[model samples]
Target: MSRLIYMGFKLLEPYEGKLSRTVLRGESGSNPADLPDKAIASPLMANYILYLYKTMRKFWGEPIVVTQELGDILGNAVIKDSILASSDTICLLDQSKFRGNYEQVAKLLALNEVEQRKIFTINGLDNKAGRGKFKEVYIKRGNIGEVYGVEVSLFQYLTFTTEKPEKTAVESYVARFGSYSAGLEAFVSDLRSSRLGLADFIMQVNAE
Candidate 1:
């Protein structure tokens, strides 16, 4: 029984813009300025992933699997090399890698509607050409347990603020539409109260 934890968190804006271009880009790095605006924007996401990776390392003392989102942006060879240099593993989190027998369990326990929608979009299930492709491509590729693993865990770190004047985009969006959309605050409140129970549930599911 290998130890596995699946963790994820929403992207947050960094304080003070503390991550420098050189630090993020690494030595002998390409000038992000030369890249397209979209390419340049990805470094911030990559930096955040790195931050999470380091933070997780402190707790688990092990290498971990990460989503393709992280892998796509952290294209710098030096930084990637540094990550791989560690004794633990850092493999791509893909459907193909999932273990058998945990598929239904994952669908029932791991994903909510929002997450399912996101997965649908990621795998092009919503696209005309790719309609109904999610089951064929995504789910068939791996069970949730295989993708997240026992060592994998998700963390959603949101900086919520009621200060209307200083609200971030996400906060504003939630506030404006939360009542109609999905009771975002209520969900968070429930999550806070039931997190321990959720963890236990996951452990029990994995155990079986």
Candidate 2:
């Protein structure tokens, strides 16, 4: 039996549903702020969730937890009266096995530099027992990219910068003419628009 306490914006109606269901997956629980370390946890890094919740409260009403009937799960947690939502993030608390797997998945996702930089940053990294976690955003991608079978020499020679906040390094790639997008439609458009081969495309981007 594992438990998770997550924070998400109430302003986004779609996300409220998604976040609530996600947190209730097992013998889980939630807290408005941070929960104790006995359980694994990850939080969002930005306050964007707070801004959305406050701005959209009138139309969507206050964000809330949906009732899911389960034994000893969904423990009592307070709904804070304050406007500043803590972390505006998602936290997962679960059994050791699930926690390990979850952290690995988070790491894998974070490896996708564009998505990682856009959504979350690697605040803390550890492989220790009973205390591994990563913070991320609640924002869902409005678009997804597809591989284009194109490659170019100049595109292959661009070197990626190794600088502070490496996650945003993809932005530099974009500045050098790399096209990355979340919208599938836009992605398809860009892919079709390109004339480079797949290997050459990666090489060009990597060189940048």
Best by TM-score: 1
TM-score of each: 0.23, 0.19
Q: Where does candidate 1 stray beyond 4 Å?
A: 1-10, 13-41, 61-65, 69-74, 90-208
TM-score of 2: 0.19
True-vs-predicted CA distance for residue 141, candidate 1, Å:
20
Model 1 agreement with the true structure over 1-208: per-residue lDDT tens digits: 1111111112122321222423343323221111122331244444544564464455443324233333332444433544434424322223333334334424433444444443434333334341211222323222231122122111222233343332342344356565523444543454456654433433432343
User: Which ten residues in a row are the worst by lDDT in model 1?
Assistant: 1-10
**Residue-level lDDT tens digits of model 2 in 1-208:** 2333232222334654544454434323332322233221122312334443453443433343222221112221222223322323322222233333344334422325454333332233243233312222233223332221222332222222243333233454445454543332332234346765534433454465
Span of ten consecutive residues with least summed lDDT in model 2: 70-79
